[model samples]
Target: MHAAGLGKQSLLIPKQPLLLLHGLFGFRELGPFVYFHGITEPLKSLGAKVVATRVHPTDSIANRAAQLQTQLSQVLKQYNTDKVHVIAHSMGGLDARYLINKLDWERNIMSLTTLATPHRGSYIADWSVLNIKQKLKIESLFKVLDIPLLAIDQLTPQYINECFNPEITDVPDVQYKSYGAWKQFESKFSYLYYFGQLLAEREGRNDGLVSMDSARWGQSFNEIPNCDHINIINWSESKFDIMPTYQKILSDLYHLEQQRELKWSIR
Candidate 1:
């Protein structure tokens, strides 16, 4: 349930490619910085074909999902592989879900594992959509700034509950699992503390950006302790290391893939 019982070790070499999807305003890489820091090298070392995808940094869920689909399609064609294992974080998880369920990618994506994804929705986003007039005014502000704002509006509780979730259902036999990030609010220097405080009153526990309740979407729901939303991606000033957690996820994904394949083997 926590970021224990996990360590760096030789991992199962995946036959199917692994696709890494980033959250809101995420980039595959910027100079030396990467979205999933300390992730790609290890996966490549494990002989896993990894594709860290990039989509529009700030965009609507539909637009983001379309970009994801295009990238994945290109990757699949390039690698000559039909199956892929998707690991998504934050809003990227929503994008993955949309591609898999709404965009007819279920047959290609064998499994989806999300971390700190606001699958149900987030209170912080709801805070923005206080009322119709206010929300519209905010939208107008974004337009004046020449910034697209659908992604923010879509992250609210109302959108996911009444609109997105109702329309998107997990395809049968497509494995879905999710994990949450957990951290104690101790640093006023970090904004996550404030967000966590607000989420605590409404959603129990959170990883600053998304509540544990909101992070849960699929089957397995676990919390990576001592991790905030940013630290889960290994961008932390604290001592909490994220590589072990990622290792655990990759190992579990391999085993799950094997099991699924065995279950459906042409016996």
Candidate 2:
């Protein structure tokens, strides 16, 4: 029998849709941004709609959050649902938090799953500002990520403490989970690399760019080894195995939803 013949509710279990947002210097199409499609596909197969977002490449967190608010508002209106599940990567994680805390979208979301986000500012950002050659290399490689926006000194630790401390009452109703990645398996860079050294010094275990401590914030945390900063979302590498990590996250999120449902049943 055709799916259409089974009726509207036969195969579709409608819940609030999932939204995917990429990191700085990222687009909806880049290699580092493409693997999310795989994760979303599994979700859609489970009867959810996944919406991927594109934002101005150099916009501030505040501006980006405002833009996402508008976009999410439209998604809610279009689907006739008041909430969404957000999955954000890297700087996009900060942007998501901004949407919840700064823009007051706590009531309009269900949960958040952040992947390899630098909740604590990266020392690499600090190092790059001091070394012009490094800055140029980063700008050349990831041109979309504006250095001015990522300046570590300008981005005081206090900023991180204020925004992502989990102490802040940003989204009182939202449940949060974080995924941290580390470059445990062999990678191109070694500890001698400045960023690697920074990672080692600050986090002890890092994803080549961000440390585990930085990525894992709030109460719930998941950790994945053998993945780097970009590999957490990138699809180009065979060695990275980002798919399994995302699959595990999706499974955990599903379990969380089930737990919530059980709680409601008890109520």
Candidate 3:
């Protein structure tokens, strides 16, 4: 029922592999999803083809989802297949959720693996706004959108209302899993870096963008430590091993492979 040999590899290059997406204000090239060269290559090593989706990272999650849907439609047509799994980061997960829950695409996807996605919004995004230093930075995109800084106090109920939670979105039929990373901010100049690092240090958890409670929106969660939102890609120039996280991610996908077959048969 899983399109025959969903996980098994053969001559045709297997399924459409994984679709990776970037978060808000994040382009295809700058984030860990893209900057880290080995990110997808390692997944490819698992007999899967990887596709990085490009969308206007600054756009609202709704708009981004619409654009990604268009992109995904083309990709599916190109591969001549209807099912593809997703690995999204930060706000990218929000867009992915919209694709499955809002666009009537529940049946088209096999699994969703979110890394540092703010399922409940970010507390740091709120804390940063109060600081005068944060007001004039490129990372202030969210603050700019809210304007007057204090308008929506980081992950406010209103903010969540606007981003998601309209009409009680149902959890889709496919497998879902998440990972989170966190770190502490020691200084202003190092705000992004340190916060990202804290998100990474998760004594028990991260990719540093979203907290454990915020990231795990699926049936199960794959916990990792010492990696921030972008660190998930790679440590830029640092020689840290990101394979462990990828391994956990692959494990989740493997489970989804089985789950998809079961669900397909049920249908």
Candidate 4:
């Protein structure tokens, strides 16, 4: 759709609060470098209570999940609500899933909408930790830099297939939705374009980092056209506008919530 056609007036507001969870190396608010730039305010203006959470930027999913759980408790108490709808980007989605499944947070989460998350795995992560020798070297470097490299390990296909998949179970009560994006073409200015090309060559269609197939995990999935990994969250940076896309997502959730309430009333 065209950018001009995407207006906030047409967007529907949901009853539940929205908690925005950022991806790996992401923060809640970093001065001018906010993770999901120009997103929360518009959502709030639409009559939705929006809260962007802060988690350990480079920590493992379990550790980040714990951090999110704590933040979630505070947000729920502040909003006086029992549950919240989550809009998580990239690795944040996996963190939310870990919280819900492994940390007993299923009852506290109403719905989860994942954007370009590596559900199965990312080839980049696989490449990084290709062999035991390489993994050890990378881990040592991260340790020297005082950065958590365990999170990187968790993103690999081997880790997800062997360790994560077995423990993390999807609860039937929680509503799940996922979205993927693909880079249109390569550009010398954009590093994501180069990565996208590399991934497309190696792992089929991908949004720079995460492949479209890897991002598809929830009950419902969507593909956003002409968007790279970073631009999928902030499409205003690219030629495509993401405002309409986000509005549509919120509208869909609003309708879904209405339907859920109606079903409860009917029962």
Instruction: Give me the candidate number with maximum lDDT.
Output: 1
TM-score for each of the candidates: 0.90, 0.77, 0.73, 0.91
Worst 10 residues of 2 by lDDT: 1-10
**Which residue ranges in model 1 land beyond 4 Å of their true spot?**
1-9, 129-141, 144-146
Q: Which stretches of candidate 4 lie over 4 Å from their true place?
A: 1-8, 130-138, 235-237
Q: lDDT, candidate 2, residue 131?
A: 70
lDDT of 3 by residue, 1-267 (tens): 012222334222334567888776666676434543566665565576778888774556667788888878877887888888888877788788888887888888878888877777665555544453356663466456753333223233347656465742656576777777654444456426655554445322333446777776777776555455666665433354666666556665666577667877999
Model 3 has an lDDT value of: 0.64
Residue-by-residue lDDT tens digits, candidate 4, 177-203: 999987756677786766677678877
Alpha-carbon deviation at 180 in model 1, angstroms: 0.5
**Candidate 1 overall lDDT versus native:** 0.83
Evaluation by lDDT, superior candidate among 3 and 4: 4
Error of 1 at 185 (Å): 0.5
Best-to-worst order by TM-score is: 4, 1, 2, 3
State the displacement of the C-alpha of residue 74, model 2, in Å, after optimal TM-score superposition.
2.2
Off by over 4 Å in 3: 1-16, 30-33, 128-158, 161-163, 166-168, 183-208, 236-238, 262-267
Candidate 4 root-mean-square deviation in Å: 2.7
Better of 1 and 2 by lDDT: 1
Best-matching candidate per TM-score: 4
Model 3: lDDT of residue 26: 64
In candidate 3, position 101 carries an lDDT of: 86
lDDT (10s digit) by residue, model 2, range 1-267: 011222224333336677898776667766544635455555565566788887765556766677787789888988998878888988788888878877778888778889888787676656655674364655455456434344233233455666545443446578888998776534554443456656687668987777898888755898887667766765435444566565565566666667777998999
Q: Using alpha carbons, what is the TM-score of model 1?
A: 0.90
